[model samples]
Target: MPKLRVVSYNVRGLKDDRAALGEVIRDLAPDVLFAQEAPRRFRWRHKCAELARSGGMLYASGGLPGLGNAILVSMRVTVEEAWGLRYPLTPGRHLRGAAFARCSVAKVPFLAVGTHLATDDTERPAQAALLAATIREAGGTTIFGGDINETEGGSAWRTLADTRTDAGATNQTPTFSVTNPSRRIDALFADKTCTVTSYSVIDTPAVRRASDHFPIYAEITL
Candidate 1:
């Protein structure tokens, strides 16, 4: 089976150490990037395009209208279809959304989704439920990545993990507070049909300085 390298990152709206971020992403050479906190304000499309081009990739979808969630794909993958979705907004809370791409690498197809859930404890569970339903409807070997904003034993986490494999469930590497990490809030989940070959929390110096949260990487076979 062919392996697909995927990365999930929270770039903090590309507001910090963008150069280092670009370098780290380039070095990782991910086939697909599930980016959270992507630029969503003025000239967001231009910024997303520039970031993708700088990282030697093409803008696949998401961002702006997707409430800052975005996807970038390397040329090795062929995107069959792509779309963005906004979660129902909760009054007075941050707007959340997700991006979906049905893609193929070496002719093997899978559905990928990128998202960021609300930081509010009460809000996250509902959001996770909606996200899981969306994934169920996506159909195919499904892969999801995001800043879940909740950790192990949390309702939101459990909701998503109920049917999918949480890549970090056993490893439990912290991926937040880049300088002195102590939380495992970011993660990747995949359908059982997909094999999770390897997973890691990227913690190199460049990655630490790139954003408030470290990137999580995974290798999956379909």
Candidate 2:
């Protein structure tokens, strides 16, 4: 079986403490990192690009203004396709987007989607449905990760797996409010075709100071 490490983190627009951020990534060494609330400015993207190169990961970030959601994968992984999603309720601003990257871990091809959903109950569910549909259309074992901003048992959470039958959904272990560490706003959902071996919340006190939301880590066998 082929296993790969993945992480979903909201970097807080690169405002995270630099040293802590670097250390977190270095320690985890995730094959794929999905980051939300990342700045969209050129300087910000350039800085992230630099980090991706230096950290041995490739980055794909392009959407609307202000902290565009992004996906960074290891050099060994290949991004075959990508897409963006816009909400009908919110439109133009507060735009939420999702991207699907086709890649392999240890030569095992799999699909990974990076996304950040809305806070509104109805909109969030609709967005989740759209993403689920997008993955089904793509046709393969898929994984979705990012700061969903929704609580456990919420409509959005419910909708994520509503359209897919071959998939198993896992609420990412708690990852939020690095300082206090209360709710779990982040998540990682994978298909039944994918086996989850382990899950972790990686936002130690030091790392918490780096960003508001901690990183959710998981290991999957394909």
Q: Each candidate's TM vs. the true structure?
A: 0.96, 0.86
Model 2 residue 161 lDDT?
A: 52
Q: How many residue pairs clash per model?
A: 0, 4
lDDT by residue for model 1 over 88-139, one digit each (tens)? 8889988889989899899988888998999999888888888888777777
Give candidate 1's error at residue 139 in angstroms.
Answer: 1.4
Q: Number of the top candidate by TM-score? A: 1
Minimum summed lDDT over a 10-residue window in model 1 is located at 131-140
Q: Which lDDT value does model 2 have at 200?
A: 74
Model 2 lDDT on a 0 to 1 scale = 0.71
Record all residue pairs in model 2 with backbone atoms less than 3 Å apart, i.e. clashing.
Answer: 38-67, 167-191, 167-192, 168-192
Which candidate number maximizes lDDT? 1
Tens digit per residue, CA lDDT, model 2, 37-115: 7656667667667667645677754334223677788766777666555545575446667766677667677887778
- Candidate 1 runs further than 4 Å off: none
